[model samples]
Target chain A: MDTAILIDIVKSGLVLGALYALMATGLSLVWTTLGIFNFAHGAFIALGAYLAWQFSSADAWGLPMVPAILLSCAVMFAIGALLHFLLVKPFERRQDIVLISVITTLAGAVILENGLQLIWGARSKQIPPLAEGAVEFGALSLRNSELILMGLVLAILLCVGLFLRYSRPGRSMRAVAQNQDAAALLGLNVPLYFSMVFGIAALTAGLAGVFVGTIRFMSPSMGSEPLMKALIVVIFGGVARFSSPIYAALIIGQIEAFSVYFVGLYWAPAVLFFTMIVVLLIKPEGLFGKYQRTL
Target chain B: MSDLILDVRGLSGGYDTTQIFSDISLQIAEGESIGIFGPNGHGKTTFLKTLSGLIDPWSGDIFFCGQRMNREGERGSRKMRNFNYGAVTRRRIDPKAVARAGLIHVQQGNLLFPELTVDETLSIASTAARGRKGWTLAEVRELFPRLGERGSHKIRFLSGGERQMVSMAAGLMAAPKLLILDEPTLGLSPKVRQELCDAILSVRRLGLPVVLIDQDVAFLEQIIDTLYLFDHGRFSGRMGKEEMPDHQTLMDMLFGEAH
Candidate 1:
């Protein structure tokens, strides 16, 4: 393998990993807090991209990329709060909530996806890059947008880590994740925090969507692929620990990059599925988490 | 009575369709530390949960700090409705609001997050019920010296007594006006129980109200002056501090009766 080729693969893998990390963080947050999978997560990512595009597109609002991303996150947060109250909270205490929430979120996802199609149409769209041109590092030349993508994603993930560790509200959230009853009894507002968790998930998911639009392309149905990949990362990372899925995302990214290079892009999904099955068979608890039966 | 810190009337609450306690009533004056001793599975913990807003009452009123905290409208409506139906429509007490109003419930089994260290647990607890000036980290450190010594150790690594200490410390950090403790010394050895009882006495000295539920009558006798006997989901009656039973005598009465 050429050194330059290896660097390109590593660079691409890191970029892919950043995208997965952002998407998986949202998925993992929702799952850990709500104990229900948000099937609408993919739609959330796609919608975020679409929202950013609407803000930044020369054909639309034509805002700058930074402010557009910010607006996208804010809108995503509001939508998350609304969906949580309207769609998720109603079924929260149901004896079969785990099963029921999926349906509700799936309904939400279908609506959002189709709504995207109705609004944005079926054409593939890409957002304006965060940075134009390419950067050279020795023998390798990297797209400036990809480099920015990796940096921005890593920054967000780092911020999330710090927030959960040191911030009072974040610690309260961690407390809830550890024991809901305890958190509530301590006077932590469980429902409000649940809504906030959804909001955070939406913010992160929405940001990932914008990245996808910049790095790849966005269509109404584009969210499904990334959503599937994120779900795999969450399962591989497990819900017991907060940082587990992050490392899992990066590892999966490298595997994906290498596999796509060695094999073909079309066969990547098969290889990934095979890898997931093997990981599950060997360690049902996840790579960094204790065996926790969620749902 | 200075003020009724917690006043309960016609309190009927339980999990699901099963009524664990029915028409239970109790009162605690300001700065009053009370003990509840009951046989296992007789709704003692459920009563505390109901009071703390962890679970909603089927029919009851909880007046905390002269404010109605628990849902007065519940009044048997939840019981009358379909099973688990209240999950959706039962708009009962928001435990967070209850806690914020200065009533803190120290739950059973310690319930501390296994991943959080004693320091981290206290740090998070400081944010809870932030309306009141909580016990400073220094104050909590003074109250539970063991916590200070092992501040960095995760809860899972702590001893049973240490976990209980962290739970109590966490509750105290919330600056609780009324602290409701459910089995603080459930499975501790006599030495650890004595240590906890002494620490609880220190809390009592600070003029904080406490509601203790424990099988250890000896431990309760050491701290609480008035003891309530809860049996079959009702308060059998209140016992004067002097009238509280010894451990062996209460044990015989509660468990050895069948044998």
Candidate 2:
């Protein structure tokens, strides 16, 4: 590839990595803490994207993008809590909760897709970029939209990391993730924690949706791509460590970007999948996950 | 002096449809230590669980501090029933109610949070016991001096003995009037077991009533003032501290002549 093309690939990789990290961090948190691999996570992202698209237009509401993003996140949080209570909590004690969550989330994904089609119609929708400019540095040109997405992802990740590290409820969630029975004995309400954690996960997915929707077209099926990418990133990063998703996302993004330029568009996903399989076979615990007693 | 701390009359409960124990009645007074001795699969743990509100007895009444305990439908119930074969049934009694009633149950195995430092665990325990004037973290650290040194270490990094001490300290932080210990020394080394026994006796010295449940007669003999021998879901015999028999008989009762 030419130097300009290489620079473009590198920039694309960083942008993709940031969005992937944002999407997968919540999955990792839920997996490590609640032991539930929420397949509907992508659906939440799609919902956020569609909401933002609806709000971006200067209709009677005329809501700004930042406020629209926050509103979408808040709505997603409530939806997340509802999902936890209705779908997750009832099956909490089941030994097959992992499998059940997959099926449940798959059902949720289908429902969300169809529901979006019914309400918003099947046509693709777009949200205008938060800003209308591009930054050029040497051979590389970065869209304002990409920078805004990166900024939003970083800000959300920092807030979430701080919350999990410092807040009392956040500490309790960590404690439960490490040892649930102990958390309960300490009078930490396990169900409440589950709901709160799921809500946070949904919030992250929602913000990511807005970023992704602004950059690309929003549709019912938009969740599938990022959902797959997030799952791959989370598995590659190891579920136990908090920073695993970031590293995994970076690696995957760079490889995807490079493969797209060197090989073909269809070949990039194949390379990503091959990398995931190799990592799983070589180190089943993912790159950063620790082997510990799970709940 | 005649007040009853816990009273169970005709209490019966089991897993699924299979009844493990029935018509079991027991009572404990203030500041009295009772040791529960039973053979394997005799429902000793089940009984403790039923009392803690972790499980629902099939038929019985549980009264604590003169209040009838509705184990069937109460929120955050305390009945703790663990099953090896099937689903474990656990009902958490409201921590507030448990504190008000001065009851704390330290379950088997290492129940400490693996990610939390020993000090954080104790601090959380102290905070949970804020409604009640219970033991402080400093006093708990004093009780288990090893805990003092390992305050910053996570429970996962601690030795089995150290973990047990942390669990005990967390339980005692509630300063419960009635402390229930279910197999407190299951996986401990001999030295650690001895330390745990010493800790129990020391806690008893502070005039806190305790319910120590174990299959080992020798350990119970050291700290228990009274013994309730359980056999096949029934209380087979009751022995006072002075009336306890030799090791051979207790061993025979526990394992049934090894054949």
The best candidate by TM-score is 1
Residue B81 of model 2, lDDT score: 26
Binned by DockQ into CAPRI classes (incorrect, acceptable, medium, high), candidate 1 is medium
After superposition, which runs of candidate 2 have C-alpha atoms over 4 Å from their true positions?
A: A54-56, A293-295, B14-19, B53-56, B68-70, B73-102, B130-133, B187-191, B214-223, B245-249, B252-259
- Model 1 over residues B25-120: C-alpha lDDT tens digits? 788887678998888889888888888887878887889888999755764454555554534566588888888988988888875788777888
The estimated TM-scores of all candidates read: 0.94, 0.87
Using Cα atoms, each model's DockQ against the true complex is 0.57, 0.28
Instruction: For model 1 chain A, give the 10-residue run with minimal summed lDDT.
Output: A286-295
Give the lDDT of residue B192 in candidate 1. 91
RMSD of each: 2.5, 4.5
Mind giving the per-residue lDDT tens digits that candidate 2 earns over A140-216?
Answer: 78889788778877888889988877666776677778776555554556788889889999889888888888788
- What does the lDDT read for residue B218 in candidate 2? 74
